[model samples]
Each structure stands twice: as C-alpha cells, then as structure tokens.
Target chain A: MEISYRDMITVLHGMGFGVLFMLAFSGAIGVIYATTVVGPQWPRSQWDNAMFRFYLISMAALAWLATISGAYIIYPWYRAVPPAGTTDLSAYPRALLLSSPRTAGWHDIGMEWKEHIAWFTPIAMTMVAYVFIKYGPRLALHRQMRNAVLGFTAVAFFSTAVAGLFGAFLNKYAPVRGGPDIVLMQEK
Target chain B: MSAEHQPIGLPTGPGAAAILAAGIGSLALGVFSFAGDAVPAINRAFIFWQPSGALSGVTITAIVIWLVSWFGLSRRWAGRDVALGTVNVAAFVMLVVALLLTFPPFMDLLQEI
Candidate 1:
C-alpha cells in the first residue's frame, strides 16, 4: 500500500533499468551471433540491421540509466552520514550494514564490487553497440573482431549478472530507505 | 561472398579501437577502484561527488580515459588495418584482469601482498 520514494527509485534502478538491460543482452547477443556467425542462414536486410541497431541502442541506454541513477541518486541516500550520537541507522544503508559484523560483508563485498563492477556494463555495452553499428554486415568477415565483440558482450552480461545478484542480496540485507512514502493503494 | 564480404579492403581499425578502448576503460575502473580502497589519500581524492563517495570519481575517470583513448586510437588508426591478433589478445587480457581486479576477494588477496 505504501512505498517510499527512495525505495521506488531503487526498484526502478535495479529492476526497471538494470534487469531490463540484463534481459536485453540475450536478444542482442542472439541477433549479433545470428547475424555474424550464421550469416548465410539469414537475410541481412537493411530493416533487420536497423532493428538490431535500435535494440542495441535501447539496451545501452538502459545500462546508462541504471548505472547513472544507481550511482547519483540512490547511492547518496544509501551512504548518507548519520549525525552524531545517532542510534537508529535505518536511514543510512551503508552504515546499517557496516554496524553489524554479521552483515558487514554485504557492504564490504557486495556494494564495493557492485558499485565499481556495474560500471563495466554500460561502458562495454556502449562500445559493443558502436562496434556493431559501425561494422554491421561486414563484421562477419573479421572473425577475430567477431570473437572479440562476442567476448565483450559476454563479459558485459557477466558484469550485469554479478551486479544484479549482489544488488538483490544487498537490498535484502540493508535496503536504501528514505524519502516521502508514496501511497500505492489504500488498505481496505 | 561478394566484394563487400571480402576482409582485405575493409577497415577494421575503428572497430578495433573501440574494442581496445573498452578494455582500457574496464581496466581503469579496476585500477582506480583498487587504489581507492588501498590508499586513504587516493580514496579521498576520488570523491568527486560527496554523495557517491569515491565511486563517482572512479567511474568518471575511467569513462574519460575510455573516450580519450578511443578518440586517439581511432584518429591514429583511421582506415589502416592494424594487427588485430595482437590487439585482440591485449584487449582480452586487460579486460579479464580488470574484471578480476574489481572482485573483493581478488582485491583482498592482492592487498595482502
């Protein structure tokens, strides 16, 4: 019935953008592989190439959205400093996780890795998009280039998976919470 | 395969530049992240935005390096066909090493040395 603005944004960051980008990888890779690896089986029409570019562009956009929002918007709330003699640390996710030895690993490992590793997603995907767009059908000719592209795509996916997995667990352990509560529906 | 499918006349340097640049960017993130964790001074220096802590600087710097390197490499390579084999190996090595460097366990292990 009620979700805070911070929580909603976190969900949008992790699910709306992050997970959507993750899901888009499959389609992107499949098409890239199909177009490159199995070139003869399919027609490399201009429309096909255009749609592929659009799909990759959208995926890259989602990757940027997820990374930017996570780093700029929600992270500030998550890492907010607790005033002197503050007993309750629910408002500060980083502090809340660190306050407990049992939960400290979640912050130290989960967040530390996610914060930096998640970045590779956008950078790699953007490059992947650019390479694909620039090379297009000609990509099939350069076997080495094709392999490298696939490798980067797979790594991009790996980075997203690692970040997503850790993100879900981190939220479970110490969620980024604050901001005005948004009412979803009135409880009858 | 038609003339267009032929690899000889085609330009791969631009694509190669983008690929290598991504590897460089990824490695930069790893190196910066590790340095920020290992050194207090480095950590403080990386706080470009107070809200995001060192992560803001780490990512921003890496992106800048990626773009700059890409631009420089692309301009230099242009239509010239560089050695794709060597570039591929170097890029993959850097990328994989960078990925491992970001992992906390790997960072911890390296820091212990």
Candidate 2:
C-alpha cells in the first residue's frame, strides 16, 4: 500500500509528542529536585556537589542529543529535499512538501548534508560542555552560560515536540487528494 | 536496625549483579551499534561472522564489566554508589535508543514513509 505524507505525519506526531511529553515531565522533575531536594538540603554538601555535577553533565548530554537528533530529523527534508509539490510556503517547506506525494523520496541524504549537520552537533555540545566546565557555577560571572544550558534544554525539547507534531501532520497529508481522496480510496 | 545491616553502596546479591550486568551490556551494545554503523568491516564481522558480533558484542561486554566492577570496584566506589546506578541506567537507555535509532525503529519509520 502506498503511504501518503499524512500517514507519515501521524507517526511523527505521535512519537514526537509522546517523547516530548516525557522529556518535559522529566525536566520538570529535575527542576523540582534541584530546587527543593538538592537545592535546599544538599547544595553545599560534597555529595550534593557531586550529584549536581552529574546532573549537569547528564543535562549537557541530553542537550547535545536532542539538538543533533532534532537536526537529523528535519535537516534532510529542509535543506536537501526540494519542495514536494506544495505551494503553501512557510518556515519549513519540506515538511509542507509532505502534502505532495511527489516529494516522498526526494530527500537527499548525501554526505555533505550529513556532515554539515552532524558536525554542528558535536561543536554545539562541546561549547555547552566547555561553558559548564569553565564556569558551571560562579553565577555572579557565568549566569549567562548556566542559563544557556537550561535554555537550550527547554527550547530544544519544546521545539522538537512541536516540530515533531508538525512532522506527524505532514506525514498525514496525501499527495493525490489530500485527506479526502485517501478516505475515498480506502472505501473503494 | 544496626548500622551493619543497612545496604551498602555496592550492589549485592543477585539483584545488583543482574542490573550491573544489564547496564554494562547495554553500554557495550551501544558502543558496538555506533561502531557497526560507522565501520563496514567491524559491522560485517559482528553481523555476519562468528557469534554475530552485532548481536553478542554488547552482552559480552556488559557481563565482563559487571563481573569486574561487582567483584573489584563495587566496594571501592561505595561512597559514589549512586553514580554506578546512574551509569547503568544511562547505559541501558543508550543501548536501547542507539539500537532502535540505528537499525529498525527510526530507520523503518523513515522507510515506511
């Protein structure tokens, strides 16, 4: 059976939404733990310091993973893949192109594309790591870096979820008849 | 209860060993998964050669790591016991996610579309 873009969009949406929801909940838990449990009781203790360090490192890893994964998800369609067959242009035409069946296999998973995005991930991750390493604490001077870590974590996760949902919807769009045509074809 | 009876930092009994084993296996699997995807020879050797390196590489590594750590460093790393647990959990997640992302789930998802 020939799957349409809408079908693909649904999958992306469901999986993306599910994972994002989980990450957001986990992030909330981390925040709560940091503020109430670790922040109040163990902030000054050696154990707390160690735990904090571990938590920060984990967060950094997570940030890097999400950033790269997000890029991987959207980049092929966005940069290399031409517009499928749609005309409603917006921020992400490739995703919009999902409305067109013609663009299904149009994605260019070439070496240049892979290298370009893949390399960005490590660099971004390293930068984040360096900041934490150099000035994870000392909020008086490095408040910006600390916030950047937190900010990247929050924003990347949120965007990933939203984009993933859009991706899901894009997967749902049909090339021939959009949504109605598929239903008719199914009925036939 | 006496202080002597409290659970120590090290994993004990069959339970700890199981988790330790699983965790190490997961990490090893993760490393191999990435390696296998990146390298054709390594991938071919493990995937097609004796024992199917892709299948058993992680499990074997996990068992070895678990045994060594359980017997050797379990006691030494008592104070930092939590880190051990965290490492295991992270390893487990990494193994599953890496495998899923690489071979079937994510790849299949894209292919289906």
Candidate 3:
C-alpha cells in the first residue's frame, strides 16, 4: 500500500481541517457558554443531596466499566485494522488516503495515531458522564429530550451494527486491490 | 470524598447538547471534507454501513438502562435525595455511544482494500 506524496499531503490537509472544525464548533461553543451562559445560569442543581449522590456513585461504576471495556476491546481492534504501511484514508467510506513511496516514513506516524486515538474514548466518555452529573438534566422539556435521546440512540446503534456486518463480509471476501505489487490480504 | 464522589454519570442539557452537537458536526465535517477526495473502493463498499456499526446496539442498551434508572431513582429525584435520575440517564447514554464507536466500523474501512 504505497501512497504517493500528493496523497499524503491531501490526508494531512484533511486531518488539519478536521481539527480546525472541532475547534470552531465545540471549542468556540464551549468558550461562549463558559463566559456568558454557563456563568449566568450558575449552579441551579447541586449534588450535595443524597439521591444525587447515590446516582453519581452508580454512574461512576457504570462509567468505569464502559471505559475499561472500551479500551480493552476497541483499542486493539482499531490498531489491528490498518496494519502499518497503508494510507491514512478517511474512516468514513470512499475517501482513500493516498501515500507515496517517498512518504513511507510517515506510515509509522499514521499507525501510531490509529493505535492511540481509540484510547481517548474512555476519557471522553468519563468526562461526558461527569458533566451530566454536575448539571443534572439540562432538558427542561422532558418529553422532547427523552424522545430525542431515544431516536438518536436507536439510529446510532442500528447503523453501527450494519456497518460491522458489512466490514466482516468485506474482510472475509471482497477486499479491494491497489497497485500491482501490493496484493490485498485479509487479517484475522 | 469516596469513590462515589467522582463516578461517571449522565449529561444534562448542556452535556447532551455538547455531545449531540459534536457528533453532528463531526459527521458533517467528515462528509464535507471527503466529498472532494477520491472515495476508496473499499470505503465505498462499507461507508454506508459504518454508522450501523457505530450506533445501534449501544443505543438500545442506553435506552433500557435509562428507563430502569429512571424508575429506581424516582424516589430520589422527588427532592428526597439529590438529583440522580437525569445523571443516571446521561451516564447510560454516554456509555452506549462510547461503546458503539469502538465497533470495527471506525477503524476497519481502510483495511478492506
């Protein structure tokens, strides 16, 4: 899976753009709220009470499991997928990250990214849970929030399952081939 | 502060919104950025299915957990104990989402070729 320098450049550009997008969207929104809305809203909810305290304790347990399990299972699988020399193609479908012979050294770096990125999942999940505990339910509109969470979770789960089956099939049989020297091989 | 003082829980309005917004934003950026690049043949085959691997089972699990927690914490949320119900729900939801993303979909697309 030798990628051309041009392809490498494109992939790097895409990564840069992704980081920028995150900064613009989440980082910017966070800053604005912390400075204005979050401060003014202040702490309407407090965990000082017993029930809140119990719930947080339980949530902590669940979160710890999620983090440990996710790291143990997902991280290794994620690292194994790309092998070492393949291009840093978009995880989304269709975009083949092109890499060249000259830029082969970069493959080591890209592999490192894949190995480490999934580890962030546990940290992110933990943080998300912590925030929810601190603020309590932010959705004053109970009906709306419940419905939205149900719908979103439903879609996410279904889509991910379908994707998994598809990948399994592809890995089993229909691997695509690239340049002549590099024959596609399936890994366990 | 016991281990209970700092356990992972659920997200409220701001937390939920942040995750939702970020998910939508990432999906949007993924699409926008990849639109111009050459779609890898392997990616083409599995792209549509990736979301399936990323979102399904965890979503179902999260919903179930939330409902159960809602019932269990009903006593507490009634002002008897601090607010626990919502935090429980949020924690469950976060766990589901995080677990699902670990599915092979996010990492295996490139390997197909």
In model 3, state the lDDT of residue B97.
Answer: 47
The digit string of per-residue lDDT tens for model 1 on A11-47 reads: 9999999989988888988877886757633336888
Q: Which stretches of candidate 3 lie over 4 Å from their true place?
A: A1-141, A174-188, B1-13, B36-113
lDDT of 3 by residue, A13-41 (tens): 22332222222333322322332334423
Q: Report the number of clashing residue pairs per model.
A: 0, 15, 33
**Order of models, best TM-score first:** 1, 2, 3
As for lDDT, the candidate ahead, 1 or 2, is: 1
lDDT by residue (A51-90, candidate 2, tens digit) is 6556555644554454444344433334333356745544
Q: CAPRI band of model 2?
A: incorrect
**Structural similarity to truth (TM-score) of each candidate:** 0.95, 0.30, 0.27
The lowest-lDDT stretch of 10 consecutive residues in candidate 1 chain A is: A35-44
Provide the lowest-lDDT 10-residue window in model 2 chain A.
Answer: A110-119
TM-score of chain A of each: 0.95, 0.39, 0.28
Please give, for residues B10-113, the per-residue lDDT of candidate 1 as tens digits.
Answer: 68789889989998988999999999999999999999999899989999999999999999999998987767777889888989889888999999999999
Find the candidate with the highest DockQ and give its number.
Answer: 1
Q: Which lDDT tens digits does candidate 3 get at residues B1-113?
A: 33222223332334444334334332322332222122455234433324333222323333344434444444333323222344445544644444333333433443354
List, in the given order, the native-contact fraction of each candidate.
0.87, 0.00, 0.02
